[model samples]
Target: MVRREHEGSVLEAGQALRRGEVTSVELAERALAVADELGVYITRFPEHALASARRADREFAAGVDRGPLQGIPLGVKDLIAVAEAPTTAQSTVLDWGQGIDAAVTTRVKEAGGVIVGKTSTMEFGCGVPDRAKPFPIPRNPWDTERWAGGSSSGTASGIAAGMFFAGLGSDTAGSIRMPAAFCGVTGLMPTYGRVSGAGCVPLAHTLDRIGPLARTARDCAALLEVIAEVPFVAPEFTGDLTGLRVGVVREHHFPEDADPALAGVFDETLSLAEGLGATLIEVTLPYWKELTTAVLVTASCEALAHHRAELITRWPDFGVSARGIFAAGALVSGADYVQAQRVRQVVRQELARLFDDVDVIASPVASIGAPLLDDVADEAGQQNAEVFEKITTPYWNGVGNPVLAVPMGKTGDGLPLSLQLAGRLFDEATVLRAGDALQAAR
Candidate 1:
């Protein structure tokens, strides 16, 4: 029965607590046990978790309760600091003995949420893992051999594996959504500045947004309200895509070399939308390639500026792959970075015009299902996977638009595939409303 609770949504788990069917301590224990079995947790906070849960139980008994998140167990991404807990960022660069709490941690604690532990993240928010670090690579829950996807790999894996109800994750260039796509969970990369990034380790200062990964879109919406401090209204949208125009960006829909199974999943996902009254239109945006190029150029320059001293002084402390990428930023010229930003402005202007013709843009969240860990071990396979992922994901990063990745279905091998829904800037509510309707139909 406790195992069943692990599979339930946040609402279901909270209900179980309210009804006296389970105590907070028992729930925390079960979450820890599951994490141990699945190898999901990086820093297990057994003592802190139990103390928080005990306080929650006492509050409930005293007729005082917080919000829906009151007693829910959560996984904190290692990128975000949580007072006293060692935040390794899955890199050996930091001395594990030191720790400090960030803004997000304080907010969650104030809301009565119990953070179970910190989950692993790739070194400094890049996708590749560093084995040189003390932490182990995060395995996908659906297929252990496959990559779980991204810098937020462990946070996504932990939530999908039912170690926690929902976990906090950061997205700069699809870090949150990519992992969520591979793990068969829902992830939202909220609008820029919608959620605070005050204490998060930066990958790209202008592009990063902190959001939640959960089993369903409704749960994500609830979490958005808490973190973003905005009221969520259920999108008044209903059945049939007949009048709702969805633009399938001809250039961004799928890569020229997308796997056959992934393409089929994408087509089926479109059909599902078409069946519900969505009209699919093929359109192309001007300078889409320039947008992505600009993002990489600017991000590389910014990252170099942030980590210059650390790279020079403690070079060996970093993982080889992570260091290689971050160090390349050292070569990016200031003139080129400014040129990229200029191109970025032009692209955003073009995207604004494109959106005037359609309500939403549809694309695959990833080019292929999760690949085997062994395939990514060597340099050739690593390069192939990196290029494949950037093809579908980085454009949204370039535009800084609000995008949501929802689990559409699974691949033949049982891994998950997802559809990306992008809305106009700062208009996440509309995208999520559409997601809620589509998720219900599924």
Candidate 2:
């Protein structure tokens, strides 16, 4: 029998399963109970989940193990296709029939990960929270009134609330990391092309990448090892960064008017790393504003292109926030799109040069803790959120590098603060190593 307080890490759950201390059915039931109370899932398939768990139990009894993920319960963001439920993307505009099992879904299923259900998300993976929509507005688990940084809102919130061990999330421009930071969970955005995007709804074709959100960096590594198309090796956390070189990008990354509390927490994190035997060096990023502008233009154009027909034919069906965001993409002319790509090229080149001098670059994920939902619920609040949410995550998305967002500290009101560590292209091992070390130290 699984205890009621069995909110263990992914590895701990796996160990318990191996030792016959608990069954996957018990874990799924526990997660479903939490999801029901927190409104974390957009769609729930309790019957199907229990059936899958039973099968996993039979496999373990037969001495046939899939891997670490065997019998683990996980949720799929609504944008990602799962065989058990429809992909709503939290929008009435999407065709329910279009949701099919995506590549990541198949991988998780094959690895014996029980699919709990489809979680909520921003409509089409962009836009602010809209209560007018049919879906539930995902709230931060910590306060219940604050925003869970999105567009990967549900996945991060669910993980933080212990709805499941981990879940799939997509990041086009800080979707995964932002929500994780706001919800006090860990999120990883793997290098572009590292994971297959087939079967997931497109927010921005060129910019979108799928990854995991969990309670710890090690849990993320386990999920990544199972789902990543490219071969991955989990980094060993030695609790000591003896030979690591971390580049601290503070000037352009954190604005002068940034939250003092967040900055203080970041400074403390740097000191912690130094105490662990890592050398911290100050560095400046070039074309920071240009890179950010390029991300907006590129993402807007791509998103608009993908939904042009829908926007033209059935515009009113979309949530007001999503409709407005998609409509803006129409203003991006062909030349503007091409020029944004050129800017991206230059930014990527500059980041490559910077990485030559540091093993990984560390920066604040956002300028402040999660804002109150009331502060960003309306059009004016949404606009303020767009300006006030000064995030450095999108820069790495444009540069096509792997980034890990780890919980660094909390604000006075008790909301979580996060730090992002970015590494060379396809070097998620080093990035995860750094994140793991930080978690171990904490």
Candidate 3:
């Protein structure tokens, strides 16, 4: 039951399940035993998970296998519907979903992934924690008082704390990658529209992408393969970045107030990429500011469209952080939204041209590590959240490209630093392969 054996292990759980070294129920129990301590689960389905694991064990005994996720204990984000639990999306506003599974949930069950339970998320996937509400505040496993990046909060924290091997996380503007980065796990934000969003609470319909967060890139690929309905197996790649062209971007990600240790850790990662035989070249992302702006404006407006009535009728029911964001949508003009879309197209086209020169682009996922919990829940903290989206996640989300987040190194105080690898649209294979190569070098 050592977490290290499964942390970076790709289908090692599945392998053990098939070899009779362990039954699915044991893995489920191991995940369940440590679940409550990390503030990871919004709902715990102990009996249901054991039932699913028993079925998986029976299938394995019959010499039948679903895929990489078979017999693997996985978590579904609270925002996604599960027949075993209500869809909370970490809010008191809406909790009516029941008796049916979300599309991704059905996919997970079909692949024989044992659903441990629903993991926590921010309010409707757009807010930070609010103590005024009645939900659990997700704490980082590395340091409980430190923030475990938002919207997709508990899934990443749970993975880092060994609650579950991997899980589904939705990213509209960095929910998946941000938490993954802070928690020091690997999170994949697949190309938009690549995975269906049905039955999951919508944040920004056009921007929302359902993807996997796991301990490693290989594990993310395995989960994504089932949810995305595409083949993601890479061929014998490890510490071999030969002939790989990587664009190193530092234009916006390296902010002025960045942690002093950030430069050193990020530079070491680039050196490792070079040591592994990849060519690194300096490059600037086109329309970085405009695209980031588009993301904020688009997310707020779209989210507002969904929650405007509730924001009016049940004003205080929404979290303080969620209200501030959803209210901003009221300030945007129709022309402004149109302009954002136009700029999105421009960035997408320009990035497409940029991708022709480099096989993948790389950067530090954040200029600093996780902020302290109290600091992240205050007014200044909200501004920090804006800076976070602008610098790290929005640009890629705006352009509809697949991005992979991996632990690069640690800050002086031992917080995890993350590296992101972005690929061409629908070209997750390249990024996952590169991310795996980077992680293998560790």
C-alpha RMSD values across all candidates:
2.7, 2.3, 1.9
**C-alpha local distance difference test of each model:** 0.77, 0.85, 0.86
Clashing pairs in 3: none
Candidate 1 ranges beyond 4 A from true positions: 1-5, 35-39, 95-99, 229-243, 377-391
Preferred candidate (lDDT higher): 1 or 2:
2
- lDDT digits (tens) for residues 1-442 of candidate 1: 0133457888778888899998888888887777354346678788888888888889989988787677788998888888758777777776443356666677777767788998877788874665556777878888787778786887888888888898889987788898899888889898777788867878889777788888877778767767774444435545445677788864655666665677777777778888888888887866867776787777777877887898999998877766776777878887888888788788888889988998888887877787776665457213344444433677777777888899887777767888888889888876786677688787
Please give the lDDT score for candidate 3. Answer: 0.86
Candidate 1, residue 259: lDDT: 59
| Weakest lDDT window of 10 consecutive positions for candidate 1 | 380-389
Superior candidate under lDDT, 1 versus 3: 3
